[model samples]
Target: MKHLSYLNKYFLKYKWRILPGVLFVIISNIFGVVPAQVIRNAYDLIVENAAIYRLYEGFDRQAIVYDIFSYSLFFFGALILFLYLLRGLFLFFMRQTIILMSRHIEYDMKNEIYAHYQKLSLGFYRRNNTGDLMNRATEDVNRVRMYVGPAIMYAFNTTVLFLLVIYFMFSVNATLAIYALLPLPVLVLAIYYVNTIINQKSEKIQEQLSRLSSFVQERFSGIRVMKSYVREAHAQTIFAEESNAYKTNSMGLVKVQAFFYPTMLLLVGISTILTIYIGGEQVIDGAITPGNIAEFIVYVNQLTFPVTMLGWVTTLIQRAAASQKRINEFLQLQPDINSGSQEIDLNGNISFKNVSFTYADTGIEAIKEVSFEIKQGQFVAIIGKTGSGKSTLANLLMRMYDPSSGDILIEGQALDKIDLHSYRSQIGFVPQEVFLFSDSIKNNIAFGLDAVTDEQVNQAAKDAAVYQNIIGFEQQFETMLGERGITLSGGQKQRVSIARALIKSPQMLIFDDCLSAVDTKTEEEILSNLGKLMKGRTSVLIAHRISTIKNADKILVLDNGRIIEEGTHEELLNSGKAYAEMYQNQLLEEENV
Candidate 1:
């Protein structure tokens, strides 16, 4: 219930609608309860008039008395029908106001969660899986909507109807009202006991559903790997086990609900029986009339639905409370990184002052007190072996993370001081792991820009050396790719990713081992094209091959997260150090190939 307090702001936002909805509930119940009294009065009219007609059976005016009796009963019946139609109309208005408000709130809640998710740091994604995040925004929000819409509506309707019905019954005769309501206290206790169990079960079910969703999402995304490894049967077995567990949990909830509803109906049934028996005895004792007995019966039947809904509304609220708690867990988390207010052109000399970074999750130092400088228009190359922190440098430059110690500066301004969006907007980064969306090839190339001409996409593809491959397709640039660009070869995917970065026409370019999937000939051609385009723009190249970066103005050779050698290609080759050894080995490998 406390967790559900988060929705108070939304309630306040829609207060005007809610207030009208409450008014409709009250009006509708007033009409609803009055029908029972109308029917009671109509019955008493028939009973009283029939006795008069019997007394006049032998008189000459008996025919006139019968006609009058028939017309009065008809009027009362018509009034009851009219009252019920009015109740139905107000019920419709109630749904329109309150239920629609719930829907609007659900829409707002999902958008807010999605926007917050985008603001969170990469570390947040690493900690929470995608399925759990989706469940909170979608399924959990839906459960809360049940509380917002149906539960709130029925709770109000029930309370109003009960109060009105009880007032009428007690006004007629307190003995019958007392007897009819005696079973309700036990109903309240039953709901209180069942609500706690439902809350616990609902939370467990949501957690298990999230796990199942994650399993399915991962398996679908990696279906190729599973097939290549011939593990389809094994995957199926595991899926079956997970499905069975979900079923088992669902059945546990169903069992409690099974016990809940019948208990409610039994108490309602007891109330009805007591009403009939007690009202009959009072009629015989002359404390009340036969019409009074009929009225009590109508009241009991009128109260039947609202009493049953008490159990259902309790279930909905308990489940909603559990779901809101899960949603609050993420909504309450503040993002680890906060953006700065500074906005400026980011084209300048870049410097890292003794920068060091450690991955918080693995506790492994990826960058250790490394320092470097890149002038405004210099082409700088960083060559390293596997696990030497090449990609980490690219991530840091893109501001995906902040260094654990030291500082990064662009021109004279601190990197963190610059507005994050403004800084990243000027840089084109092609990651080591190429990922393209499931869209047309042209669209993937033009993805970073808000708008682009087809000619620009074509030119960028040519510059990345993927133009020939793309044109060979029947649809050319319009060819649609599968997930992660699976329709293309590994080399083509990397080339398309490079084209996407190039299409941005940014002030700085960072390519982190983007040419690994392509052959040496394609790599040389792409580098030649890049050289022409990178003129007067700061560029950082991280590579495993020496040939790709031999023409750069400055080359850095890293080993074990440290810059062991720094010089131009010629200087490093002559130094006979790690860079020289790497170059010699690559040359021999090329000759053998």
Candidate 2:
């Protein structure tokens, strides 16, 4: 119950549907034994003298028996027909209500997990892989649904019918009832032992499945690498290894189930055989009537199946419990970052005061006492060597991750004091690795806008200098891109990402070398267009090429984790330090060409 406590609200919300469904299940199981009950009456009529003395008063005794048998057969037939009709109707209600309720709850649980996953911090995502999280949201939620739907209903049905059948069997003949249950203790012990094994195996199988999914996800994402390196065979081997591991674990679990189910069935067979032998002897010795023996047989037949289903119900419970434990591991996690209560409009005045950060897992500092400022409507560039924390700095400003030390201020207010949503609404980001949905070019461009018209999309594309290229395609704006913009060239993808951010028209736009993919001519054309767009807005650029940031109003040169130089492009070159050397190297390469 504690493992499933997260779902208490949903259970309570749908109790109206569940209660009536359970009532239907109860009524169905109760009357399910009616056919067996009437079997006893049919036997009694044949085995004993007819009690209707008036009807046979002037008739032969055999004739009277014949008439009694005929009428009894009709009565039993009609009762069975009616009971079966009732059973079918009740089953319909149960399925429609309880099973349907599970589906609704299943839908809610997926939404619940998905919504919570959205709220979870970036750190949470960094800690968990996509495939594992996907497993929890989809497969694990389905396992929980099994516990509520068929397992709960059938478990309840088994218990109630078992009790009623036992009561009837004992009343008919106590000795016969006791003999029929001789294997009960053995079966219980076997179930306990087998379920323990199943529990361990079920969890292992789920883990292996997640790993297989993750392996495939990673390989597909890096398929270009695999193909370019001619390592397709190697990738196949890796996939086979993961798939084999999953299959082996699955087969092991199936083997356990294979042996356990038949053993339980054998026990049920013994129970049936014992009732037939003992009840037949009792009828011969006159300890009980033939009707009682007949009734005992029907009750034993009815009881054996629910008992057999106990093993399956137990398996379902264990699987659900295992899935619940896995799901709870994430559902109970508290995000590292929580939203602030204050709501403030931003004017893009940003200041990083003694800001520093160290990744929690690595314990290595990315930024060390680095401080900078960007006034409204300014165009600033960050230049650095590889692994020099340029992208990390941009990430901190985006609030994807927070600085470990010192504060960032927006318009004189502490960054944490402003509502996160409001602060983010004022900034648009195009990351180094551009991403686009598998959708039309127009939809990708207008991705972040609340309500954007086609004119807005076209304008943003034009501003990105990609409008002509897009229209050159067969579908123009309606042209579809594959996963991660696979159908588009690298330059086109970067421009589309730029268009997506530009469509938002935020006060501050951060471009993390998004123009790196384009040639020098196209980059110049985009930068010229961007200059006009940045007339009254702030822009931050992180780049490697000197030409990209040479016209920036201010440039910060980072070496290792420290800011080594800061100035306008000309002032940096005049300083004859790191920035000057970088400019000279670029000039030498161009001249050499």
Give all candidate RMSDs, comma-separated: 1.5, 2.3
Best by TM-score: 1
Candidate 1 segments exceeding 4 Å error? none
lDDT of 2 by residue, 1-593 (tens): 56767667887999999899889888887778767778888778765545554456676885867776788788888988899899889988888988898899899989988999998888787777888899988888899999888888788778878988888888778999999988889988998899889889888988888888878887888888889999999989988998999999889988988998888778878988988899889989989888887788788778777877888888888888888889888888987778777787776788989999898867879998889999998899999999899998988888778889999888888877778888888788999989899999999998897789989999999989899999999999999998899999999999999989888888899999888889999899888988988787899999999999999988999988789999999999889999999999989999999
Task: Please give the clash total of every predicted structure, in order.
Answer: 0, 0
TM-score (C-alpha) between model 1 and the true structure? 0.97
Query: What range of 10 consecutive residues in model 2 has the weakest lDDT sum?
Result: 46-55
Clash pairs of candidate 2? none
Which residue pairs clash in candidate 1?
A: none
Worst 10 residues of 1 by lDDT: 339-348
